[model samples]
Target chain A: MNPYHILNKLLCEEEELTSEERKAFVEGLKSDPELVRVFTGWLQVHSHLMERLPETKDLILYSLAADGHADDLTHQEASYISDHWKDIDSVVESHPGFKDLTHQIAQDRQDFLDCWGSETASVPQVFRLPAWSYQIAAVIAVLAVAAFATIFLVNYQDRSMQLAIATPGEYQRILLPDSSIAHLSGPATLEYNSERFGRSVQLTGQAFFEISHRPKQFIVRTNEAMVQVLGTRFGMRSGNDMTQVILESGRVQVASNETPPRSIVLAPGQMTDVVKGEAPTPSIDVNIEDELRWTGFVFLRNTPMRKAAVLLSSSRNVNIDVDPLLMRESVTGTFSPDIPIQEVLDALTLTLNAQVIEDEDGFRIVPLFP
Target chain B: MAASKFDPQLVLRAKKGDERSRNVLLERLSVVLERFFKRKIGDQALVDDLIQCTLLRVHSGLIALKHPDKFKAFAMKAALFELHDYYRGRHSMKERSFEPELLPEKNYSINQSSGDSMDVEKALELLKPRTRRILELREHGYKYREIADILNISETAVKMQVKRAFEKMKTIFAD
Candidate 1:
């Protein structure tokens, strides 16, 4: 029942104290000065270990085995505690309180283990986290990942999809809220409410669409052409010289105000290069993913240095100059848009002995060896 | 309400992509952030600006905020981003100026006070695992009685370990 015995049990593996006995000691501490000081000191050590021992648990256990679990008790530790157990033994000969605390701590641990065992052994099945926590964790993780990926896929899809006829302004590819795809071309701007699943767009400069297969109709309309489809791949062009429709796959009946808008069976590999007030002429050899390569891949392996440099310039929307002397070297690497310019330079420097120097305008590649 | 119980429940809801749950977490955490950032950013003006920007990002990006339980670290990172942006934007507008040499190696006044707390943590590390457990329960806002109950040790045992831990801290700090 003595506080010291409880304290000792806590320090040693004496055993867990009963809940009622521990509670009484807590009440006793309010009136005891020595108890207050001792408790505070224990707190200091406890927190210190908790914060640091996360990665050092095994090491501490190893030390425990070596040192017999008794931390080296220096003169200070002795003074801090009984200050020479033998001498204090006579002074505190009547202090039966000390051993009991240590004993209770051990007893309590045993009690806890007993409780843990009963709960565990009674069940034949493996323990699992609470249902709500497991369900919530799974749902939250999936949704959060989906939201992130949606943002990513939508951005990537936007880059690869373009609006046929854009105005003479900054072109932006829009992932229609419905997952239907469209690339904003020319100077025209296309905006989609990604929060909503409606595949509606207003067009200026022409764009193309690989509309996602869905029950809803995907619609794109410009001043010249209004095109509708169930689910198809097609390209439309609106410029000074012409308004054209190129169908890569699926079917689209192209109609326009200026031209007698007629039905076009645009099969695979068909390019409808249309001029306003003229017949729709289908063409060939369309590099769809390649055409949008600027928004897709800035770094290409085994690509000509000059061409890669040009691609990097447009892709990053930064002006970069390559030393003409290194033009003949074939460049090979993969680069993400998020890569820092320094990292890019480091890769080049390591691979080709190429070094990059910087100025206010941009970066210039210079070879260290050549 | 119990701090331990409240934190995990809020964290669970927030992690489950509940925007409201995240808002509650941020609200609970705003107090912690105020304390955390006040310690880091000396200037009151910049601190306020950074806090505002961080909260704005948290609100707009709640659904996008992946780790809801690690709200404290997440918010701190947000503040860091805001600070980076502010300095970058300011650099663009201002003329070139000489910057002061901030030698962190030189121990300052604030370091002295915190240095003790650090010593305390270090000293606690020297104790055996059981002693360490008893000490941690006491520090994490647990009552000696509660710690005894939780760790199944006697209150006196908890007290002894605490005293022993303090002595260790004093020594560690002395070193």
Candidate 2:
């Protein structure tokens, strides 16, 4: 078969090229630099066509609404929107018809509100996300930096201290050189020293532990506090200048590392927060289940897509762009953070009747039909 | 990694039996949920029923949600369950596919691009109408066989037309 035939198939269709064809294309691109240039050109043209293709827009809104199958072109558009919502105003502004469509949507949105009995009475028309949104985003960035710092700080230790790190939007499960299991949420790191049979773990960010009981007390050292336990279930969140330890089903002694240090014993269902330069405080009455919600699967009952995107973006470490216009739209469903980002995007796209465009960089969510 | 900014205050309020906050949260998600169901079922009447059912399920289960931070994922999970149930019901109807009872308005328009780098649009405009339709269908992720079925043409014919369209695009770009 002609190689261009295979290349054309890959370029034109939304479905992935067959593995055999993809491999052939890869080999061809490698051997034929001209083919690479042509492929790049085709990609550029394809992107432009994707933008201008009216069918792509129709399919994005109707394909799933009309049929359950999400079209690939629409998927690309959705991913683009998710990644580029901030830049979309320029795109929309340039499109002469989009202004009219936005108006129509705003008007129809009112009709949609009437059908739903004016939930608007409860939800304000506009929610100006406070300027601190960036500050909040910075916390995740700091936690990510801290994760790396923890690894570098432990560099002098036995080379056997295995590091398990989760970036934002990711989770890492480590079988400590001991039999204990550590579930690390992203922007978090867990360094296990196996030499002593997982006797010590340095944790930064949020992690859930179901430690195995051993004769020796397992020591967990964090920036603000040290948690010592024999064996039990607990979760610790240490970052952005505060350390919180929640004992879910075990007893733990948390000691602040501050000068004139203070310590507290926490029973199951107790929680404590320790800040820099302060001693660990007394355990507070709390719901253990709530403290450890991140350890389990996530189910959104009636979550604004804006909030969902924020939660999913931070957890998954993928940038999800929600159109400011569609920020108020809510999504209701059960989803596990453990699922592939594409699946989550697919569900969100299908659920919101939105379009998701995924380029090589990341995912974008476009909530409006236009 | 830990999520930096969860709506802890809003969540705390909802958890404390603040029905108003709960309503606010639900109302916030309503548009997204509506779009979700409308996308899958494409039936105006059924979308309302499914939304209510999903909301009722959320209401019953909301008290048990310990962390409001996970509400989005939790709600999405419920909507997904409802979606599965919808498919299951549609399947029991014995139709080959879940045909939409109503089609949404296709009012979104595409403007022709006019710029130095927008030659692709100009090239696209040059294709024959039937050829353009076939390419557009393919662009929308339809298989050649499906496009053939939709256009009342043979699968081989669809492939030939698509190939020809690619050749035309290449020629236009090469110029």
Candidate 3:
């Protein structure tokens, strides 16, 4: 029998197993190692699913218990909790490991009540009218009218304060009225308004901008540095000392083009870095996509380790820890953020001999290559 | 039954200082809770701790519930109160015998307790107090929205707490 069939049989738990059928199923599993692996994997997945949900069986038991007052599950009358507890005496009585902990959790209910009960006061009645006051209903009518009028006159008035969030590895395409395309990366945020307002955007974290080739100047501001491009296809990265600009197309000069800003002419495949308070460096050949991975692409032609890892972390919406010494280690390879974090970590480990440790949020990388 | 009968919109509205809404909402959720618990507990003495409290908590903290779509999960969280409370009562008495027919026998081996017990315990300990409480609620199969109401926190927070708790657990287990 195939693994899927075996898994289905296991799940359904039907069809009495004859001696011949049992032998055949085991024989089939043994004969094909690949099938056995799949079968075991399915079994493991089921086990996890079961563990993921603890009280389902108890819920079923509750449903079958056929008690009348217990039927009102909405009210915690102590009837249901008593019967459906996952760890009963039978399960924990002999197991010394679970006995103390189970009892501790059980006994702690009083403690929770002591803390929580004090704060749970009755809801106070809001402003009220006379018991039969006609004005009470009339007031509601007036408020409704005012709310509708305000909504009709000015739509929501909330674009300024609302923060947009994107899930990991998901891309949000924001289109400005001026025909500018912004591919916003997950785990990064940028706030902006229409061109009529200021034609400026406040970018706190990392993002890519293919600014519309417009008459007015387009500016992107970060804490470390600012990049002003007019109708250009380029990526500017700024944060701390790691300010960089990778020009892909169009002709645009950076602001206050001083030696410190590192004004450098670049062709198709060059990237420049302007360290905070330092001059911008000369053009060096690099992968535009890798440098701009937060915006779109993953592989860098030649990228710093920390930058690459940050891109992967942004893609996964995970915080990663990296030792300071490993930030400068150069890498020339490709990584797909859409791929599993494990696979990406494996690539870094096997290729660079780095050690990755798990944290509550994500992973930390320590350099072992040296 | 019609889904709207327990539709979360009415319940939340009542929780936020509306009396009529509260009565209507409570009445609706009561149906599901009653059916679920009546079958599970088989004891009237415990119903109040199991079902009544979840409803009351949901009623009192309805302001915290944002998503009506997650009502089922919230109800499940509310159910956890009874389970945890029941365990607590049992702990006080050191009573071991329960509705024993449901337990899986082989998992009761002596050696099994020492290894898995400490790992689960520490992970439970590391959780934020609210998360620890919520996990206990969730483990007992309380509805997600009910948990939100009882904790007076957002559903999103509950989700993040669970995810963080599990991640911490995975690390501890691995270690």
Sorted by DockQ, highest first, which candidate order results? 3, 1, 2
- Per model, state how many residue pairs clash: 54, 45, 52
Q: Write the per-residue lDDT of candidate 1 for residues A219-287, one digit (tens) a residue.
A: 666555556777776666566755566655676665554645754555554555555555556445454
| TM-score, candidate 2, chain B alone | 0.49
Model 2: residue A338 alpha-carbon error in angstroms: 6.1
Better of 1 and 2 by TM-score: 2
- lDDT by residue (A1-370, candidate 3, tens digit) is 4543443333223234555655566666546655444333322322332253334334333432222223333344245557555544444343332333343333333333332333223333356468767677789879988998798546534533334445555565554444454555665566675312345765544455667554567776655456667776666655565666677666545432343454555565677776656556777887665556556645554667788778767666788877787778766544433345665665465335577888787888886664
- Give each model's whole-structure lDDT: 0.50, 0.61, 0.52
- Give interface RMSD, per candidate: 24.9, 18.8, 16.9
Q: Candidate 2, residue B97: CA error in Å?
A: 56
* CAPRI rating of model 2: incorrect
Chain B alone, TM-score of each model?
Answer: 0.41, 0.49, 0.47
- What digit string (tens of lDDT, one per residue) describes model 2 on residues B1-175? 2321225566668778898887866666666677656534444577788888888877777787766765654565466556545533442211111112111212211223467346665676687766767655544344554455556554445655665676566667566
Over the true interface residues, superposed, what is the Cα RMSD of model 3?
A: 16.9
Between candidates 1 and 3, name the one with more favorable lDDT.
3
Recovered native contacts, candidate 1: 0.06
Regions more than 4 Å wrong, model 3:
A1-45, A48-77, A86-161, A164-288, A294-344, A350-370, B1-175
In model 2, which runs have C-alpha deviations exceeding 4 angstroms?
A1-158, A296-370, B1-175
